[model samples]
Target: MPEAVIRTAPSPTALLASLDPLLRQWLPRRRWFAGKGRPITGLTPVAVTELPSPAPDSDGAPGALTGLYHLLVRVHQPPAPGSPERPGDCYQLVIGVREVPPTRPAPGLIGHVTRGPLAGHVVYDALDDPRPAGVLLEAVRCGARVGPLRFDRDPGHEIRTGLVPRRMTAEQSNSSVVYGDRLVLKVLRRIGPGTHPDLELPLALARAGCARVPAPVGWMTAELSGDSWLLGVLQPYVQGAVDGWELALRELSKGEDFAAEARALGRATAEVHTALARALPTVTLGHRAMARIADGMSGRLAEAVRTVPALLPYAPGLRSAFTALGDLAGQGRTWTAQRVHGDLHLGQCLRSPDGEWSLIDFEGEPDRPPEERRMPQPAVRDVAGMLRSFDYAARSADTPVPGWAETCRAAYCSGYARVAGHDPRTDPVLLRAFETDKAVYEVVYESRHRPDWLPVPLAAVRRLAAPGPARLMP
Candidate 1:
């Protein structure tokens, strides 16, 4: 275990005041705040954990607090159907507040506080809290045995670890605080128990020497006896890089040739699939897995179609696509199921300064079960994901032109086929099936999560539905 950093003296009153207006205003505006857009009658602070100040000034004031000040806040709200009545409904907010001089030099702190629970909070960028950041890094470098983490709902599994924290830009499910640019510690807002795929699979892959992904460093778990909640994971952060999506978009926007880049990305992705197949145990692609995949897509697609009625007409076509793909199971096309990066879109890949592509985030889709994510399936699933991403890059352009998708797709498929040893010409049916399946999934995803972005996937679906050569490039 790493050496424990002594916690700073409690300054609850000052800290509370510092959090006053900001806490009140920020909650309602946040997407994960449970009570988003709803009126919070009151906020009661249930717990506070203080840590030693990172750097203390002459008068004993903390230059910054290094440890995390985890506050369990109870937010009062009206009861909704199926909503929990007890304090269980309250959200746990782990805020890393650092006491910096009113005038500190940091690039991220330039913006003033906006609205919500943090409306009036004199909050600066928490990354300014080097004390906490350092403590987190040390924990990652040298494993630490900290207190057992308990989930409010179930208290059977006891999770204890000293993992470092690194600050990251906002993501879909949680706010990530990275550690040493090596690992990302994601604190989940919408909590649940049962091993999280993000933590489980990435660790498995890294241990297996899958070069495409960031290695897992540590994890924070919440025990509930029979099941455990994966509160956070620490994985190496790929520095000096841009996600593949942004890179592709830039290439398209500037009218630059992306064939070479796309081909390289394809090769990397194929290598990942090959590694995954070799490392993990095989499973027959039977009706159960196929049904699960199909059912999952159906549920999400149905919900999305409801949210955007404009997508109603496409839902039937999308369902048919999934159904056709699902029927391919048990045809001797099964491959070993090892842990895979559930979501493999261009946005999930990063291009290092050296121009090498590195995959990040092992947590399959945010909504799927860990077992499902860990299950082995066709390697082409990942191929489809990247292909869809290529389409997205073209569609997301300010002024998309013809032929870009074809150019990139051809290059990517060519590269992947070379490494995976799959000839598109011979496997035309299988390749087209994968692409169609991905397009269907994207249509529903974009419609619900990003309405304005629906056209990207919708356009892809329309193209696939229209029928052309299976392989875009010769």
Candidate 2:
């Protein structure tokens, strides 16, 4: 971690100063920490706010006095290896201060200190502690406005206080707390200035009466660089919901036909896209716009090629797909562009116990900048993502299931055509290009994060680049 940039601060100086020494040690351990393997070069506080502390709630044991702090710390990463690193990422840290540490081993503990005003105090991530979680929930429920951090609640929805908060443990880039089975609060760890798409998109879908998405009931925001950056969001909890990824794996094990489920999911996706088109501004994609889109795909592919030397052979074939894209766009073909779930995959979807399919995580690709996530794109971008997900799922099984992925892919397209009035298959060029681009991205990601899974995307790259049914190579 970088050296502490601030030795002192304003309101919460005492508390902030105490945590500075431990932040570096604790941050890299969390799953949400992005700059793993890379050294953090700098650390500084961009914004800090104090949230109202509720009177300690005693559940048999003696209640300890606790202080809650909302902090936005900027973490800098060294650019080395394959790609250039972001200048830095601002992370939101919710810390709870106490005089005594937890009696048992806890992952939340920042550390015990003995050098500052908090010499004898214990600091921990507040979201992992029930006491501070209750207070944070109360703030969201009452729409408490604390300094630049404003908490707001949606109409027709109310929150209940003192519902012992339970932090969700899952493979996600954000932190989440579920309150007594009624609502779940998702805290965005890596923050970007301006309203986050996760919050902005769902609210719009809710307004459009789209039931596929869980409506936002409450949210917290802070100002960064003169624009609002979303800190956290609260929505109704999907009780007993099994995410599509798990459900698909189960089906793959059972050897059950999943084409029907895939079709229904396709229908649900179409419904969401329709609602989004009506609720948000729409634009038309001309030749120039398509050229820009192709360029972006090519750029990402180039980055992937540089990082994964294994992808170098497929680079020329991938470029051919993008080249064909520009040629098609030059033919005066224009497509409609509107808001879409920028990141759509099997993991982004959930299947409720009652047999309903719902989409989650509208944050888009967390690695991409917020501005890019907000840009209007063809709805097929999401279609291609889901299709690629199905392909990945098929390969994930111990033995690659013959025809399973193809059957589901065709069914999903047919279902989408039922509602969308146009079949995604008819536009093979766009779909192939998108799938190729997505596979390229996955190759790089898996190569970096999951070397074992790297072959999955590598197989996709070969299929997409070679002369095949789905290949778009010129």
Best by lDDT: 2
Give lDDT tens digits, candidate 2, residues 1-474. 011321223545565566767887888877777777677666777787766554564543442645667899888878535677556888999877777765532538888866666677788888887766777678777676677777788868978766878888784789999999889999999997876789999999998999999999999988656898898999999899988888888899888889998998999899999999999999999999999999999989888877788999888988888888889999999989999998899899989898999998999887778899999999999999999999889999876668888898998889999999999999988888888888888887676556789988888888888865555321
Worst 10 residues of 2 by lDDT: 1-10
Per-residue lDDT tens digits for candidate 1, residues 67-86, read 34555456766643223364
**Which portions of model 2 miss their true places by more than 4 Å?**
1-17, 57-65, 80-86, 103-107, 470-474
Q: Residue 117 of candidate 2: its Cα lDDT?
A: 61
Score residue 132 of candidate 2 by CA lDDT: 69
TM-score of every model? 0.73, 0.91
User: Candidate 2 clashing pairs?
Assistant: none
Residue 468's lDDT in candidate 1: 47
Q: Clashes per prediction?
A: 38, 0
